[model samples]
Target: MTARRPTAIDIVEVGPRDGLQNDSRHLSTEAKVEMIAKLAGAGLRRIEAASFVNPKRVPQMADAEAVLARVVDLPGVSVSGLVLNGRGFERALAAGLREISFVAVATDTMAARNQGTTARGLVETWAGIAKRAEAEGLFRSVTIAVAFGCPFEGEVPLARVIEIARALAESGADEISLADTIGVATPLAVEERFAALSEAVPGLPMRAHFHNTRNTGYANADAALRSGVTVLDASLGGLGGCPFAPGATGNIATEDLVSMLERDRVATGVSLELLRDATLWLEGEMGRRLPAHGAHVSPWPRVLAA
Candidate 1:
């Protein structure tokens, strides 16, 4: 008998934020807003608009507020931004953002390297931020970096991910996102970590963010879908990578993932034609070729042939 499939999957388009953060070419604020509107038009309901971090640290996200303000009026869409600390959270709130994300690294070395703090210290800081966001009824979510493996600190233990998950769950985080920050995740590792997290924090809503750096991102996503993870983060044109991860490329393309789901008889509430057009438009705006593997792979050639 064939394996059963899910009826639908939630695709959180992170191109505007995660995908564009490390790009060498700077996109104008207008261009960013246009890209977002196109994605929304392509039927993406949740788009991570920008990061409310130190512009000095990520110059690519300097126009985050400007981008967010421009797209706030898009109906049926929930816009979000990432905030690293209390100050960033305050800035996000002041920018009229209703949803926001915070991040914590599960390993001490990665946490320090990424944020110059210990894992415990990062958790404590996120706890405060989560509480504030919850009290104020703001959309509160936290992403755990290096949940599968860390580039700086190779072979992160599963226990560390669970510890961070449990802490975020207890800290009033509305959602916990597991990021394969460096794209070193395997299907076995994804299943193992997610199962561990589920057992530790029962019923805590979870999301998976993967990078196609090693060509395992789609497989990792497939594993998560089978593991009952509903929220999946993908980018248009697969246009993202972790700057800290040496030799890493962009994320799994949204069109590619959606096309696969559609071919597999799973629903993603996204239109592949629209997604394709948006990616092509994004490639044109970026003024160079983009890294969209699924478009090249033709996941549904047999279906298209018939």
Candidate 2:
């Protein structure tokens, strides 16, 4: 018997924030705003517009407030920001962002390198942020990076991943995301982990964030879908990588994912042609070819007269 398929899926576009954060090129606030608007126009409902982190650390996100200020008016678009601590959360709140993503690494070493704290310490910090968000009626999603394997510490234990996920759930995270920070996860691993997480968390929605580093990103996405994950994170033009993880690559490309999903009859509410066009525009702005496959290929082929 064939497994039941979901009628639709939620795709959270992370281009403006996660996509550009590690880039050497700095996009002006205007460029960022324009990119976000184009994404919204292409029917992406949830977009991660900015990251309220220290500019000294991730200079690409230095214009978070300015970008948010300009893109907050897009109709039907839910703009969100990434906040690692109470300070970042406060700044997002001040910027009128109603949704926020909080991240915690799976291993202590990764946590220390990314957030200047241990995994447990970052959980504690997120607890306070979650509490405040709950009180303020804001949406909170906690992403556990390196859920499959850590760059510093290879093959993070499943028990450890579950433990950290439980802590974040207890802290009142509305959604939980499992991140393949260095793109080391296989389909079997994604299936097992997400199935275990579903059993462990029971009711909370799950999201998958995969990188195409070793070319397994789309496979992992398929696994997540089969495991009942409702939300997925992708970047426009496949434009993201972890600065702390050596050799890590970009997230699965939004247009590429959309093309695959739509072909499979999964509704993403995103227009593939428009998304591809956006990637082309982004390529022009960056003056380089992006890593997204859909950006380089057409969804439909033209027919020649026989």
Candidate 3:
């Protein structure tokens, strides 16, 4: 263990949006809201509940307005939605989303594939979004996708990532997240990238989004904690992948992340017993066994104490 680490952390539940976006079986708007209510009942205060994008592009996220309309009133919970462009941001604003998360990819090819724009172009879009969203009193956040490694571009330079983080901070972003879009991040790399991002963007709150594509999501989460990151993103039941990024799958499960963090004595303000119960319900909704470990096994004593 390090000589010092954060005594508490914030875990953003991304299951309702990121977890279901790529699943083969589409959940109805009612089902999506139900899942969000369950997550809220489980003590998740920050939930990425919906994505505002074109239905033709992401059919699973078709009824973004409908989903948000139902779950935004979860008591003591702040619901957010993902937005990629100006139109998506407008939709999120109009749909009553208090927090809007925008994604910026690292490589040009990935940017083109995931967002239909280059990396530089996305930053330009963000500048405009920051101005309007701030005026509207919305909490603005940006996620740097494929920050570790890109499927098409292979290795994403740390220098480029730092530059992007600096730009986002300068453009009025309230917080920034470095996403391991393809799950190639190791523990060492996780620490290094976060350290650099912290150095680059100093006081801007930094978040991490990791995939278990190579089974290192949990380890990377530990590394991020060690590196002094207070916010981490995970999905329920470990279900997630980018539709445009080939072979990418599995976000760190909320049950697993909360269990590990609480075991380390870091207060996440989430109840693992409640998270486990929600994951089980998610598995039933997905109509198959999920890839999460904590939900399938017996809860440890510490998990129950959470």
For model 2, how does the per-residue alpha-carbon lDDT over 25-84 read when each residue is reduced to its tens digit? Answer: 778788898899999999999999988889898888888888898887789998999888
Ranking of candidates on lDDT, top first: 2, 3, 1
Residue pairs clashing in model 3 are: none
Off by over 4 Å in 1: 1-5, 294-306
Q: Candidate 3's error at 276, in angstroms?
A: 1.4
lDDT-wise, the better of 2 and 3 is: 2
Stretches of model 3 off by over 4 angstroms after superposition: 1-3, 244-248, 302-306
Where is model 2 poorest over a 10-residue stretch in terms of lDDT?
Answer: 296-305
How many collisions per candidate? 1, 0, 0
lDDT of each: 0.85, 0.89, 0.88
What's the lDDT for residue 28 in model 1? 95
Overall local distance difference test of candidate 3? 0.88
TM-score of each: 0.95, 0.96, 0.96
In model 2, the runs with Cα more than 4 Å from the true position are 245-248, 301-306
**lDDT string, candidate 1, 195-287, tens digits:** 787788888777899999999999998988877687899999999888877567888999988987888877888878778888878888888
Q: By lDDT, is 1 or 3 better?
A: 3
